[model samples]
Every structure is written in C-alpha cells, then in structure tokens.
Target: MKILHRQRHDQSSSMIFRKDYTLLIIYLSLSLVSGEFMTAGVVAVGSAISAGLLAGFNVINCMINECCTDRWVSTNYTDLKLTLDAKLYGQHLVIEPVVKHLKAHGKDNPSKALALSFHGWTGTGKNYVSRIVAEKMFAKGMKSKFVHLISATKEFPHKEMVPFYKDKLRDFIEARVKECPRSFFIFDEMDKMPPGIIDTLKPYLDFYENLGGVDYRKATFFFLSNTAGNDIAERTITTWTNNLDRETIKLKEMEEVIRLPALNNKSGLWHSELILKNLITAYVPFLPLERRHVKQCIKDGLVHKGYYKSEDEISDAKVQEIADELQYYPEGVLIFSTTGCKRIHEKIDLIMEEI
Candidate 1:
C-alpha cells in the first residue's frame, strides 16, 4: 500500500480497522472449511482472493461513509428567498443570483463549494448578507463550530506575519474540513489583507482532487471587502443619475466594472491570480443605498425597536431628516452614505430622544 502520511489518515483508521476485522473473519472461515476438503495451496489461494475482496469492500464502505458524513444543509431557493427577503431590501440583483447559485450547489452533483466575494461601500449589507447565509446553512447559524469568521487585522495585522498566517490558515482550514467537510470560512475585511496572502488560498479554492488528504470542494469561502467600493458607488450613482432601472444590473457588469479597480487598489487581493483565475464563484456587488434605501433601513430599525406604528408615524419626512444628517463625501453630490447603514440605529435613537 502507498503511504502518504500516517497522521493524515488517522481519521480513516476506524473504517480500516473494521475492514480488517471483517476480512480476518472471512479468511478464518474459509481456511477452516478448505483445510479438510482441499489442499493447503488451495486454501492459501482462497485466502488471497478473500483479501482482494476485502480491499474492494473497504473502498465501497469508505465511500458510503464519506457520502453520509458532512452533508451540508440542503436549502431550497424558496427557503433562501424568504429568509433573505425578510431582512435584506433593495438588493434584488444581489439576492437573485446568490440564491440561484446556492440552490444549484446545494443539490446533487453539486459543484465546488460556493465561493463568493461581496464588494461595495461599507454597511451596504455585505456583512448582513453573509450572516443570513450562515444562518440558513446551519442550525446554529454563525454560532456553529463549523462556521469560522476571520478578521484580517486580528488574524494577521502586520505584513511580516503573512507567512505564519498562511500556514495557520491552511492548517485551520484543513483541520476543520477534516472534522466536517461542510465548513464555512468567512474572511472579513479582505481589502485590509496584506498583499500575497490571499494567494496562499488558491490551491484550496481550485477544482482538484483531495489527494492532498483535504477536500475543500465541499467547503465554502466568503471574502468581504470594500476594495472596489469607489468603483461600485460610482456605477450606482451613474445608474441613478441616468434614471436607469437598478434591477438591470448584472453580475457580469459588476464584475467587469469592479475587477480593474480591485486589481489596482493598493489594499486589495486582486493582484493574486487566485482572484483573477475566476476561482471565485461570484462577485456579488452590494449597491450603494439611496435615500429611499436608507429610509427602509430606518424603518427596519424602528420596527426592531418595537415601534410598529403606521407609515405616517414613521414618516418619510422624518426618515429623510435623519438620512440627511449622515455625512457624505464629494461635498456637493450626495452619492453615498459615508457610514452606510452602520449608524442607522444610533441616528434612530437620537431622533426618538428628540421626540
């Protein structure tokens, strides 16, 4: 037998042990009966045949166990739609493709674990979308042990630490997938990640065999970043200024628009071929929220605060007033919310205090 690493196959030892025990039983039974009826040579040949059969059986059994174990939650498109629709608003373009890709991947003959990159301005629901996805994928949601949330700064703040971080990243992913192949790794703030670090993950993201003893195909990866936020925001503003329907925005369009900026951005991972290789399943762009979208956020905040009053009570006027209070860049043009929805709760609380 070819030996790769003893420690690596430690998890499969249980199945191997059972197979050996079964083969031994069959061999002993065959030897006992053939001893009297047949010659010693015949018995030995029979034992060899049984050993060969054991190898075949072991392969089948191992496959069965692998299939049964680490089965991810099979969520339907309708279920995902309901879960995301209730929480996310004004993201029809972002939501539709995401649900479609997820549904396709969750079913039989599933492709590589859905790798998605969320880009746009801060607080444009990138993180929120990830939370909803995690919640729907597992019973414990983000709290699930299989779900790993990594902040770039906390994990690898200094550039010098990239080498160590790369090893730890590979080990962490390998160990977790070994425990449960259906693992979700969310790497937040990819824009702040050091150069060349994202490249270390290329192998795991590629479509390949698990001959290395770790299969990442069933493992999902999400990278959240604001690297191409400016480009995204500019496109959204152009769409709005031109009175174009936002629903027409396609992933292809967004990908083409964001790719160059991300590649050029100093604080970006686009320089990594892994990103340009189209290993990422989707470049889901979270569009910059207009005043109306911000108002929707404020209304959601009110409902969360137990203020389920009429629309008049939480009037558009009041919502607009609070939105106007938010600081925006490019002084004259109100292109995007500087804080996005990050400070919506605080603004709502202040508005209530004044009332």
Candidate 2:
C-alpha cells in the first residue's frame, strides 16, 4: 500500500491469568481438602468441575483479547487504493493507474496486512472510491465483504470509548472488514469518531510504526475525513514521510503529494484543460468535445448569476474576468445561501467600480 504502512513486528499475546482466576483456584482447592470424608469427596468433585469451567472461561477471554490486539497485523489488504494518484483529486482524471497497479501486483505485494485511510472534503468521493474497491474485489471473485458506511461520528462515545478503542477498536473494525475473504470498512467523517480514533489512526496517515499488538490489519480500513491544508501533498506523500523522520525521502514524497492535490483543485482550470485535451488533442479513447462545450461548463455551472448563457458566447476577456473576480474574493465561492451570495455580489460591484 502506497499510503498506509506495515512493519514486521512481534505479534505476541500476553496470557495473564487474572487474580480472580487465582482466587477461584484457591477456593476450590480449599473446598476439596477441608470437608468430611464423603462430603469432602463430593465437594472435591464439584470443585474440580468448577476449576475446569473457570479455566475455560479465562482462556476464552484471553484468546478474545489477544485476537483483537493482533488483528491489525494479521489482515490481508489487496487491490486497495494507496498513493498520491491524481485521479482521486481531479475531475475526469483517469482511474486506470490505480486499477492497473492493483491488477499488476495485488498478488505480488508481500505485505499480508494493509490499511488505507482516505479523507477529503464533503462530497469529495471517498465513499465512491471505497465502493470501487469493493466492486474490484468482487470482480476478482475475492470474498470481500466491504462495509461501506460507518457513522462513527454519531455512534462512537469518544470519551468513554478511549480505552475500548485503544484496546479493541482496530480488531473490531478489521473483523467486520474481512467477514468474507476480502473486506473493507469505510469510516466517513472519521475525525469525529471520538478523539481516540483520530490518535489511533494518525499512524495510518503518517507512517509505519511497530506498535506492538495493534489490531486493524485485516481487510482495508479506510478513514474518510475532511482535511484542510494548502498542500495536497501532505495527504499523499508526506503522510508516510512525516511519520518516519526528516528524511530525504520526504522530499521525494512531496512529488507524490503534488500529483494528488485536494480534489477541489481538480474541478477548476487544470481539470478543464485535461478534459479538453482528452476530447481534442489527445483523442485518448473518449469522444471529442468542442472547446465551446468546455467553456460552457464554466459559464453555466461556475458563475453565480451573470454567467454566459452559452459556451461560445463567452470570450477570453470574460473568462479571465470571472477567474480574477472569483480569486479576488475566494470566500464567495463557498457561500451557498442567498445572503452570502448577495454579499459577494456587493463585493463584485465594488470591484467593478474600481475597474
């Protein structure tokens, strides 16, 4: 996995017999030794049976805890998305590289356990990517039971659940992730999953550390959160480098990060240019599109009110004006309400006055 990390660390289970178990052993032994001959015999018989039951329960509990702890190290992650790939952030970007890489080496990847955490702004397609991974697993005839929706934001009791998350959440997630052969669990808006989930998952975003006995290895665990930073590279390249250290590879990773800028960057100019090239110059497996059609996208969809009604109707001067106007008052683009848009319009009037 290009994004998440895995290390060869000792996956050990501590078999601690609780004090209660010791107390039970003592009580049963005393009961067996201190009664009248016949009474003692019967008591001894019952005590032996009780001891066996207690041991069984203790063993079962120990097994459960250990299994949960090591889950992160045991799960197999195949055909998963992990990289600073541009398609994720750009509109009409090619999906072939991710799919091609997986197809080429999904089996060859040596790591038995893999985890993927995908985060972006609202409606930025994290869920869509998870679904695509699930479908790919299905195509390969892998038994992948991908859990598409995890409303951890509302359900997880972030405070009281800290120990629970640290002790067992990863195992629980990975268990559900691979109920079949290849499973995935997508946690959307995962930041709100109590602070514990964030702290625990930060490693997946940043680096590979050998935290002993951390479950969450199974299937591919995807954390979808809204992240804000000027550099999209932080999400992809620096993710691994940041956790490791101030190494030179960190710079190389920067290259990866730049390739996968936040999805928002892809929707505007550069994305339009790519789509135009595919339709016009490159002619790479897609129907050719007129430049007017591309211009029309900006005119109708981008402009708030005074957009050119037709694509060809807009001139270079008009497009440049719109770009400049939007960039000058960037906050106006996110204002969804009439109140916000009206304020932006007032700002536009001020700028026009200057012009």
Candidate 3:
C-alpha cells in the first residue's frame, strides 16, 4: 500500500511540473512573437513576466484575505468624497477637513503619523465616519489586516490592568506597524478608557520617524469619544437659536468650544500627552442631526434596506412617521435628534415588522 501511494504522489508531481513547463514555453513564445523579447532582451522579458505573475497572485490573495499589497492599500479620494456627501447627514463641518486631511495623507509622506480626534454625541456619525474612512482607504475596508480597532471598555475593562494593558497595547502597535507601515488604529469609547493607558500611544503618535527601528510615521490613528457631546450640542443649539446657518459654523469655533472640555474631561485623551503636546491632527466635531436630517436618514435607510428603490420613492409622510419615532432634545424646540442616525436601521426593521 505504501509503494502504491508513493507512485501516485510522484505521478501528480510530474503532471504539475509538465503543466508549468508547458505554460512557460507558451509565455516565451508569445513574448517573442510580440517582439517584446527582442526589444527588452531575454532577461528583461523574463523579469517582466515574473513580476506580472507575482502581481496577479497578490491580487487573488488579497481578495481571499487581508494583505499589505498595493491592491489593498490604494485609496480612493473621489469615492470617499461622494460617500461622505451622500451617507453622512447634518455634519457639514465634518466633510471638508476629513476629506482634505485624508487626501493630503494619501498623496504625500507625512511628517508624523496622522491622528484625528472625533468628538460628538452618540449616533451623530462618529463611528459611521470612521468605518467610511477605513473603507475608502483599504480595499477590504475595516476587515483589512492593517486596520486595528480597539474598544476601550472591552480591551481595558479594569483599572487594575492598566499597566499590563499598556504593555500589550504598545507591543501590538509596534508589531502591526512593522508588518505594514500604513497601519490604521482606531480607539472607540475613548471616554471610558482608564487614564494613563492611552499615554502609551504618545511615541507612535509623535513626530518621530521611527521608534526602536519601526517606522510609525506612515500610520494613522483615530480617537472617538463622547466626552464633549453636551458641549457640541449646546454650541449647535446656540447657533440655530441665533438663526445662523449651521454650515457657517467654522472648525475653529467648534475647536475652541471643545478643546478645553476635552482636555479636562475624564476620557482617554483627558490631560493625556497626546493632547498636551498637540499631537492630535484635528478635533472633528460631528454636529447633532436636525429633524430634516433624520428624515434624510430614514429615506436612506428605506433605500438601503430595499424597502424603496430610491430616495424619491419614499414619501415625506412615511419618512416623518419614522423620524418622529426617535426622541429629540432641547426642550420646547426639540431641535436635534438625541440619537442622531444611530440604530436607524433597527428602527426601520421594527417599523417594517409592524407592517
């Protein structure tokens, strides 16, 4: 039985070798007939073919799983702009800076790793924007191996584990950056993270070209927090009360309002070196969603779930019915959606079930 098994394995190996040899012959013949082998020389022709094959294999591998090849790392700035414009509602303040920063980062080698701090009320598109950015930057989106998403509450649940968590976090970041220089790290629930734990990221987020031989300058970091949600809401409400266009609210205005609160708040970034040293690239505030914006979200939800073919197919009455289901805030005015567009899909699912 052993002899017969060996004979079959040898036959299979011979078949594969013959197949590969035949393919090589056919490739060389095609190259010669096309005059490529004559002009480029035999060695150059062979190298070109080898590189093409390698690229093809890499493309296939990236489709099957996450990879660090150009296939996965390529960024689509146009698509990013279109997506944010369409899906993100009520945050005119978010669109320009996010796109411009990402475009600059994608186009040139940065002096330091790109770090963005997102602050806003829950469901105001903080997490949604993060996911969108990941999708636009990576072919596999958030599932890409280079994208590291760490939830503060889940990763560092206990204050006693801060020391151990710090070490583990440092080692993890170093390893990921070594594997892929363009690594993306996102920290969610930054408000719940224990103090001193996030300070460990100071080195990676700094202006240093390398830390211990690993180049972290090409990496990107995002810190999502609800620390300044109330402040952001109040500012937006004040703007609306003054009859000022929300779009006219500048980044500087929002930054001035939230910067102090963020530094003082008991979040991961609270008094952290990342804030004190000015390592954060931008403090993006996601403005609260108004009733009309919530209606847009409902229309989008209907279209996304296949309940409607297009936004036009959904009536204002239907959209308002779903929008009214969500709780609004600011007492008499009830100006902003308390939850923004968060869980809007679930709300749609519930309403559909009733039908």
Candidate 4:
C-alpha cells in the first residue's frame, strides 16, 4: 500500500509539471498576440496584459525579470553613450556633452529640457544622431507618439502657409508636452523655415516662474539645418591642412565659427531673440567626413543591405573606387564630400547592380 501510494504521488507531480509548462506556452502565445494588438492601437489594455504575462509565473520568470526590468528602457544611462562612442566615427564634441546633459535630466534631479541645434553640411550625421537619440531614449524611437518630427520645408514651405503652420505647431507643442514633458521635438530643415515662424516658440522657451502650465523646460528640441555648412567645411579643411585631429575639436572651439554663419545668413532664423538670447542650448557641429570616413560609410551601407562579406564580396578596393567617384566640395580641393553621405545609398546600389 505504501509503495502504491508513493508511485501515485510521483505521477501526480509529473502531471502538475506538464500542466505548468503548457500554461507557460499559452501565456507566451498570448503575450505575442497582445503585442501585435497593442501595436495596432486597437486594444487599450493590451500592453498591460502583455506586461502581466511577462510578470506572470513561469519557470524562467526570475531570469526574465532580472534581465528585462529597466535594462533595455534606460537609454541615457549607458546605452546611448555606448552607441555614440562605438558607432559614430567622429564628432566626440557633440556626443559627450549632449549625452551628459540628457543623462542628468533623465535622472531624478529635475532640470530644464535640452535644446540642441545641429549645424553642418548635409549628411554629416546630424539627422543620424537625432534619430539615434530618439531610438535610445524611447522603445519605439522615432516612431514613438511622444517624438514629434516636423519637416519644415515639406509641411510649411510657402509664405502663405506660415500662419496655419504657426498655429498648428503651437498647438502640437502645448498638447504633446502637456501629455508627456519628456517629449522630443525635432524640427528638420530649419533653414527653410520662414522668419517669425520659429519665434512662435519663444514664449514656451522662456523661463517661467509658474511650473503649473505647459513647461517647455522639460521638453527636448532638435533644430537641424545646413546653415553653417560652409563654415564647418572651412574649419575642417583648416584642421586637416594644419595636421590637427578634427575629432578632438570641442564645441567651444567651433560654436562661434558656426553661430556667426547661421545667424548672419538670410536663410536661417537664428538672428531672432529666441536664438540670439541663447535660449537654444548647444550648437552641435558635424565635421566633414574624409576619405576614410566615406569608406566606413560605404561599409555600413553594405552591411545594412545584407551584404556582409567584408573580405571577398565588399572589398576595400571597390569602396575606395566608389569614394573617389563621388564629387567633393570646393571643386577639386578634395576637402569634403559635397553631398556628405547623402548619396551613399545610390553609390551602393550602383555597386550591387554590378554584382
């Protein structure tokens, strides 16, 4: 009788284990389905359900909790820093201080929002860096609802559209920031924006005594343009000629150089009091990428397109040839790539077509 009872007990334990395993599989399936539903914005409680499933009982629950709990969420902590240092070929001056400021603000010490203005020639990693910042800061990156990307030229190109654009922009900023103070507002092609258009943001940008309504201080803004492209090119060329490391150059060294060109130019709105008064934070300069940097861009482009063979398939000789064929600015000076990295995809396509 005792032996029979022990066998029954062992069988019962095995059945219970199997049932738990089955339940775990069901929960995982539900989690995946819920994620898809959440992405469609159809189910309001889908995300909560998914989170509960993740936090639910499973054999690997402890491990999952240890790994996923705020690990991938914290971008300003070390993820952004790591990505900037590792992936970006140049421009430490832009990376260091920006990352520092972002990390500081992300922490509990409530400070004013960061306002960064990227000035350089087209394709010098200005847009790339902004996308990177958005990616690391939020799970969905640029796709996040909180990330408001406004293409000035595309949305508000004509003079007649200025008033409508201004009203829309103001309403968007106030509503978005009211919803989430940590929102990222990226204004691309700022050089194309008409005068007085940016000034609409002045009141929100100004420091306020009352922290009660629409505190823009907690919102980050990125203004990208080719306003100071020439100045940046000149400075980079000078550095190269003088045998100095361009990467080691600091923001203080080039901010004045970039600021003057942008502010004095008829194209940009930097002369406005909002900018001249220093309401805008750092002016990040992206230096011109040299031959080697161009080669690196080619390699990255190839890898992005699934052509990962470095030794035989994507040869250095081919990359150098492509770089040589690209037109450089200052016509024959070879100082900087005229298009920067803007046309790299086209070049890559040409090479792949040959293959």
Candidate 5:
C-alpha cells in the first residue's frame, strides 16, 4: 500500500508540471499573435486558473525580454536632456533645440525622416551628442543593430566607386528600415564623401509614406561634418570680441551662415539635391570650446578615468596643468583649444604616466 501511494504522488507531480508548461506555451502564443501583453494576460489568467503565481510572472518576463515592446525602441527625453547638461560642456545653444526636436519627433509621426547636420570643429561634442541620442532612444544604444554609423572616407574611398556606393547605400537603408522602422543612420565625415553619392539618400529623406513598401519617415539620419567649422568659429569669435554672451547667439543667426557655405563648399553636401530640396530638418552648430570649457573637460576626464572621485575632487592646479598641455588657437588671445577636446584622453594618459 505504501509503495502504491508513493507512485500516485509522483504521477500527480508530473501532471502538475506538464499543466504549467502547457500554460506558458499558450501565453507566449497569444503574446506573439496580438503583440501585446494584456492579451496574453487575459488568456493566461483565464486558462491557467490553477497555475501558480510564479508561472504567471514568468510569462510576463518572457514577453518583455523577447518581444518588440517599449524596451526596444522607446525614447526618454528627460534622460537625454540630463545627460547633455551633465556631460556636454558649454554649447548652451545645443541643449534646447536638440531636446525639443527629439521630443517632437518621439511624440508625433514625422512626415519625413528627421535629418540633422552637425557642423563644428573637431571634438566639440558632435559625435558625443550623437552617441547619447542613440543610447536614450534604443535599449542596446550604439551597439543596437538598428543604428548604423558609416564613415564616408573609410566606407566609400574612391571617386570612381560613387555609383557602386550609391546603390549599396540605398539598398542598406531600405533593408534596415524594413527590418526596424525606427532605424538610425549616422554618416560621419560627410565632407569626405564623394559629392554625388550622398544624394542617394534623397528619396529616403524626402516626404513619403513609403519607398518600395518600407516606411522611411520613422527613421532618423545624422550628418556630421566639418564643412562649416571655419564660418561657425569666426561667428563665435566675433560674438566674444563684441562682449555679447554666446548664449545670446541664436539658431537663425547660424543657420543661414552655415547653409550658404554648406551648399557652396566642395564637400558632400555641395550641390546635393538634399540641400536643393531642403530635406534636412536642422543645422546644429557646435561652438569652439573656450579655455574655461576646456578646463572643465580636463576635470571631467580625470573623474571619468577614475583618477578622481568627482570634478570637485581634482585641484585647480592639476586641472590647469593638463589644460596647459593642449595647444590653443589665434595666438594672441588664445581663444579656443586648437583640437577642441580631441585627444584629451591621450593627454590624460601621458600626464598620469609622468606622475
């Protein structure tokens, strides 16, 4: 009798395990069909009336991790703003419009792919801002399969290869958008791109519901170039000499300044139809970093490198010591860092070695 009772208990446990496993499979099926957790919840709660609460929780967890929910492509404007404020030094003009445009794009269905052209001297936070934007929008950040960063000089080197590059570029864009509607493409060193190749993106950037059945309007493209760096720098220098606050410099003042030159220059945007059609949404200007801002960068670098706990912990003398190591421009007034925070980490590494 004891042996028979033990066998019955084991059978009962096996039955319970099978029932729970079956319920989980059903929940996943419902989720996949409806693309919603609420639908799965209804089915699981109603069908698995006797299943343990642990099983229900497991179902929800799987849906969140495996499904294309808010976890994959949700935007957090607050985090973007806070990160820009904390990590990016100076460039007060950048924070507001960037957040505003991204917020607007996040909330509404844009008619065209949002295109932003970043113009500035090197290391003035253009690429830095792009990375931050990607991180805030996608769960996987820069490593996200949906985000594509391509360099013109590296990716399309020869002028004779323009035709080949154009076809490949178009095909890649189409494929990426088809796979993920909210894809991001960053074209770095836009100035180095062979002139006609960039115009290939014109169709994707224009106002269209879909190109070849793939909706490109939900995508975002960023063009990073030094095309208008000299013009932007001269404007900033004029503003400083006149004793006007850099914050007072408006986007309107810079847009026209950059627009004419970007179109006329021998770089990628030169005579490109994207410019002629006015497909680009905004021209973001990054100002050259002043001595004070470079000092801040140095201090931040020290904290980031783990040499100090915080910016406040680093002494002014030490910060100044590193700042002095970098060459500044214009000779007489020494207004801006010649490299604009580029190669800062290398400088920090060298300084630490000396110590």
Candidate 6:
C-alpha cells in the first residue's frame, strides 16, 4: 500500500509540471500572435519564476546573480567633461541622456552601442561630428573604434581590412562579436553602408538584452552618413532593413537621424572688395589666406566673441600692404567671390584706388 501511494504522488507531480509547461507555451503563443509585447514579457518572467521555483533554486538569488553579472561588466565610470559650448552640444547638463544610456549599456554589456548618423552635403562636418563624438566617448573612459566612410570609395574596414559588404554586416557582427566584445563601434560613410549593416545592428539599438532568438548584444554603434542636409528616406532605409531581416525589426523611419546643416557663409557677401581684404588680411604680404581659411577664422572669431568678431585688427594700410606684397591675396578679401579670378588683381587694384 505504501509503494502504491508513493507512485500516485509521483504521477500527480508529473501531471502538474506538464500542465504548467503547456500553459507557458500557450501564453507565449498568444502573446506573440496578439503582438502584446508587455504581456509577452510578463508571461516570460512568470514562466521563468515558476521554473526556478520548481528547480529548487532560490528565485531571489537568481535575480541577484543576473544583476551582479550586469554590474560586474564595468567598474570604471566615464566622466562627462565636454566643455565645448557649441550649438549642437549643450553643457554637461544635457549630457544626461548620453551618460545614462552609456552607463546602462556599460553595466549590461561589454561595450557601448551608439548610432550617430550624420546626414548632410559634402564638407558639412558629418565626419567632423563623428570624430568629436568618438573623442568625447574616449574622454569619458570608453574605448571607441571609429570606422570612417566619409567617402564613397572607402567603407568601414572589417578585421584585416578585408571586404565587408553591407548585406553581410550582421554576419560580420556575429563573427567579430568575440574580438570586439567591449568596444564602441562607429560606422563612418554611413550613407554607403548597405542596409544590411544597419539591419544587423538593429538588435543593438534599444538596450542590451536578448531579443527573440539572439542573445543580447554588448556594444555601442554609430552610423555616419551624408544625406546632403536631409534625413535618409525612411522607405529606403526600411526597405534595407526588411531586405536584411535584422533580428530586431527596425522601421526605416525609426532610425535615429541627425541632420547637420552645411557651413553657413556668415561672412556676408564675398564682393571683390571684401574678398580682396580677406585674402590680403588673411595671407597676403605675410601669407595669402584662402577663402576657406578666412571662413574658418571668421567663424572661430565669432564663436570666441560669442558673436561675429573679425580678427582684422590690422590697419587698412597694412591690409593693403599685405595684399600688395602677396599676389595670392590680390583677389581675396572679397565679400563674395564666386566669379572668375582672372585679372583679379586688376579688379582689386581698381577697387582699392576708387575707395
């Protein structure tokens, strides 16, 4: 009689376990079908809890172990010390988002996952911003790897400078995950990376966690692309995502897009007189300053003064002397010089004589 009773008890326990497992499967199926992400999450957590209790493991201990695992990733914290007060980057006050995101990622993953997509025309500071962001990440104790594709010909090199096709980026990520397990990765020339690269990185977008069948990614990624002052088309990017079928289904429009404006010529009109002066004052006699150089100086001076301030402290006579001494500055110092430079000296000389 005792043996029979024990056999019955064991049978009942097995039945209960089977029932619970069936219920978990049903819940997951329903959650997935209904597209209720939160509900699915709850079901998963509950199932995990029930399973842990059945396995004779301390539920609270397991949770603590996971938390500790996350914490043990990085003991070093980054210091946000971006003192560059520019229009784009506010003081450290606005750095909370970046800091919080990075901190959370550092705790959970081996690396930071950041995607900085710079869209603009040629010479629009897209690459510049990427470099600056990478530097700032480094400043904050993050070892960042930069893949600059600021050009169409050169894309981000995979390991060994080998061929890295965009469609194969996810495969590449999977391949290199072990090598760069804990480094901030950036993709320059983002505009050229095949949509596949973006697709492979979608899973790393939100936060570090296992999504669907894949384990959670532990890295930060940045995408730098030139779009000539407009955001990359959502349909186009989305189309790429669909084509690549990243584990994380990212809508094309959902891409974190940052549009950088082209360098505004706040130097006003580059008339012959101003152009000549710019050339003479900037480089002449001493050295002839190109239009590009003068533009930068003017912009810097404005930034320094917190407004438009020119470094033309030299007297008009000196400017003229510089212009006279350096033929390179003859046609410079113009307010707007888009026209021809043929006989620019004659034109500048005439203008100077008249003035």
Put down candidate 2 lDDT per residue, 300-345, tens digits, no spaces: 4334355435456657765445334432112443211112111334
Q: Of 2 and 6, which scores higher on lDDT?
A: 2
Error of 5 at 143 (Å): 0.9
Off by over 4 Å in 1: 1-74, 309-313, 328-335
Identify the candidate with maximal lDDT.
3
lDDT (10s digit) by residue, model 1, range 1-355: 1101112223466667676878676866566556374877666677677777677665666554432233434354567788778778777768887888887776654556678888888888988988888888866667766677888866778887777777777777777778776777888898998877777778878877573776677778888999788888777777867889777677788887777766777663757776678788888888877666777888888878766555556877778877877877556776567777878988878777654
- All models, RMSD in angstroms: 7.9, 17.7, 9.0, 14.4, 11.5, 23.3
Model 6 earns a TM-score of: 0.36
Candidates 4 and 5 compared: the better one by lDDT is 5
- Which is superior by TM-score, 5 or 6? 5
Report the Cα lDDT for candidate 3. 0.82
| lDDT string, candidate 3, 1-355, tens digits | 0100111113465456546755775676576657544665766666677667656655654565556767778755888889999889888889889999887877556888889999998989988999999998888778777887888877888888888988888888888888898888889999999989989989998888778888788888999999888998888888899999898788998896778888998778779998899999999999899988888888888998999898878877888778878899888978789998986888888787654
Give me the overall lDDT of model 4. Answer: 0.71
Q: Would you estimate the TM-scores of all the predictions? A: 0.75, 0.37, 0.83, 0.75, 0.82, 0.36
Off by over 4 Å in 4: 1-75, 209-212, 309-313, 330-335
Clashing pairs in 2: 72-215, 72-216, 72-217, 75-218, 143-182, 144-182, 233-257
TM-score of 1: 0.75
On the 0 to 100 scale, the lDDT of residue 16 in model 6 is: 65
lDDT of 5 by residue, 1-355 (tens): 0100111113465456656777776666565456464576666664565355456655565344422346678755888899999889978878888888888877557788889999988989889999999999888778776778888877888898788888888788887788788888889998888899889999999998887788888888999999899999999989989999888889989998888888999889999998899999999999999988988888888888999997777888887788888988787989788788887888888887654
Residue-level lDDT tens digits of model 6 in 1-355: 0100111113465456556766765665565546455576776776676565555333333233221122323423453324223422211222333444455655644332444333433333334344544455443322222121223234433423323443444565554444344444545554443333344355545444454444435555544434332332332234333664222323232222321121122111112222222211110000112333334433343335333244454344433442342233123334221221222344344433533
- State the weakest 10-residue window (summed lDDT) of model 1: 1-10
Output the lDDT of residue 288, model 2: 16
Ranking of candidates on lDDT, top first: 3, 5, 1, 4, 2, 6
